[model samples]
Target: MDTVAANGTGGDVTAKIAGVQALLRGLTILDVLADSPDGLASLADIAARTGLSPSTAHRLLSTLVERGYAGREPGSKGYVIGHRVVHFSTSVRRRTSDLRRLVRSHLEAITAETGETSNLVVLDGKNVVYIDQVEGTHALRMVPGIGSIFPAYTSASAKAILAYQVDDAQLDAVFTAEPRIKLAAHTLADRRDFVAALTAVVKHGYAVEESELAEGVSCIAAPIRGRNGVALGAISVPGPTQRVLEPAPERLGVLLKKHALHVSQALGFRQLSCAAG
Candidate 1:
């Protein structure tokens, strides 16, 4: 009886090892499919690239398709990256909960230091979402509140993050949609002006909006970046227009930039400022 039990345990161990090896092989095939031009690859191509037998490759691809991490083209019988894979590739939704906790202290500190409303905002599609906010002491303070989303083109926080992004085509598509014109008080007169503003923001390490998104509100923001220089989010201080820039927004801009740098460094951005690049 003890010998039979020992044999069972060994069989379980062997099965686990085989399962892990199979998973690795499956991922290798998926990687080949993902890297293919047009993002689709024939079974023969995947089998050749992964050095797996044709039947083995087919089995693995079929399993991946069943799991929604891969798909097969009906006409061509080629494997492509599945919707589930693509969906997760671009979203950090699962990480946001943990990230928010890590960033909240920085937000509170920024508000305390500036004596004004501070926000932590991230780019979501063509808009920016305010994930968190710290209200100012003043009765007339400008507050967008948490979970509010605003146009990426007109928001200082959004612009600060967008200025570091390297996708011109996506940016252009968002700007050209709808009536194109945003707020009536927006200072950017045309697409050309908007492009120039982003360029300046990249050069200056911060962005500012003055009576643009709203009637009397203004804000200054700086980008928080990842180790790869991708803008993760932005930190901004908002207040009444005159006070935001009365002495010029430069002072607050500088402070925001410093805090942004600190938070970004904490997130593993060891390189020089994204503005420098």
Candidate 2:
């Protein structure tokens, strides 16, 4: 055990404890507010969500308001996250490698191996943005390039990333906001079907699409995860459906998973192998 006697009055220790508790409570309130659709929360709602008393929640919220991290709503008198949180989030996004710097090599390698177009996609508000791409040498090919946005539910790369990264509520929200509009005849239309497809992808460690995005194109996708086990994006190889489904889907799946793991390692994922029980 380690113990240090207070050099000054006990008030200092109590103040420090109170400050730490307030900080934790304030952060919890921020999280609740961020997750809400309106970005505002009442004190009772914050207290219920944070397991804090009403007075404690009020004090924590007041401190946050004083610090300019939260502001009071006019009509409801609820607290909403302020400008500081947005600034901090924007700074973090700016610091991270923006699409091209992160997945270019993986795209190139997939193109080289499969002689097909490769794409790197990230989630953007119910859609997937094609941030980077490498074209194949085929005479006729599908060419999705940077700045192209596609529905997330219909894209293999987007589904692969979403399966590992997003929660159930977020996934529900995505489907609710963007219902399946039939990009192709085989596109998943319902939540149950989509969930089943994602579950299969997670179990097999990769995803495959056959004529979902286009008439004759097929794609194989695998997730690229970071250190925290959250998927940053997905690496995909797209070609004519005949080539991908020719002999064995399992073999193609293996190749996709292997390359995905290599890219994930490059992106700082530390694989954890579980022991047999």
Candidate 3:
């Protein structure tokens, strides 16, 4: 009986070891693809980056491609990052209960102070997902329902968070992978213009979007940082474009920044300062 029990334990340990090995191999494939310039890496490139033999790399790549965690570039016969990564990231963001709870009061206060709708959004891969919201006192107010997802480039909240959190290389990869699609006349269409806007946001401590998300709607947003001084999400106050454009964008920007800082402090973030120009 003791011998049978020992055999069972050994079998369990062997299974666990195999699972960890597979996970490590999968992560190696992703790291190799992520470092590639055009998001494509040849089998040789992947093998070199992962320090695995050609046959081993091929086997892992084939498994990743089959499971949708990697993809093969058409006509190039190279490997690249895949949509499954984004899907998995989104699922993780959606499951963050602490972030939603932490920013709830900030959203409410912004709505109370500005008489405008407020939203809290978190980065989900290259996009932003609204997780919480507070409606304004006014009967007619801009509304972005909770759970709505928007492009990180076009939304003020998204840009505010992205500008602070993502490195230039990651930002470049984002734009290259999913080019901005204009939702309104004021939306940025060119890559250089978009980069310029992000630079401006970094300098100003907050970002303002004038009818970039929807016609007749605008938003002022500031980033919420975590204890590690990394941006975790954003807080935004949104209203009609006419009201936001009324020669007082700076005032709105200031209010948003203050509220965002309050939330960031509550979340234990210490590096609260305007980005240098």
TM-score of each: 0.62, 0.61, 0.62
Cα lDDT tens digits, model 1, 1-277, are: 6775667987787888999999999877765664453557898988887889999999999899999989988889788878776556335445576556767787888778777888888876655667777888877887756655565666788678877775665466546543333454774536677777777777778998887676677889999888778788888887888878879878888888888888888888875444443
The candidate, 1 or 2, that scores higher on lDDT is: 1
Q: What TM-score would you give candidate 1 relative to the actual structure?
A: 0.62
Clashes of each: 0, 0, 0
**CA-lDDT, candidates in order:** 0.75, 0.71, 0.74
Alpha-carbon shift of residue 219 in model 2 (angstroms)? 1.2
Alpha-carbon shift of residue 13 in model 2 (angstroms): 48
lDDT of 3 at 93: 53
Error of 1 at 273 (Å): 8.5
lDDT of 3 by residue, 4-51 (tens): 566798778788899999789778678557544345889997887777
In model 3, the runs with Cα more than 4 Å from the true position are 1-94, 272-277
Model 3: number of clashes? 0
**Candidate 2 residue runs with Cα over 4 Å from true position:** 1-99, 273-277
Residue 159 lDDT, candidate 3, scale 0-100: 76
Better of 1 and 2 by TM-score: 1
Candidate 1 stretches with Cα past 4 Å from truth are 1-95, 187-189, 273-277
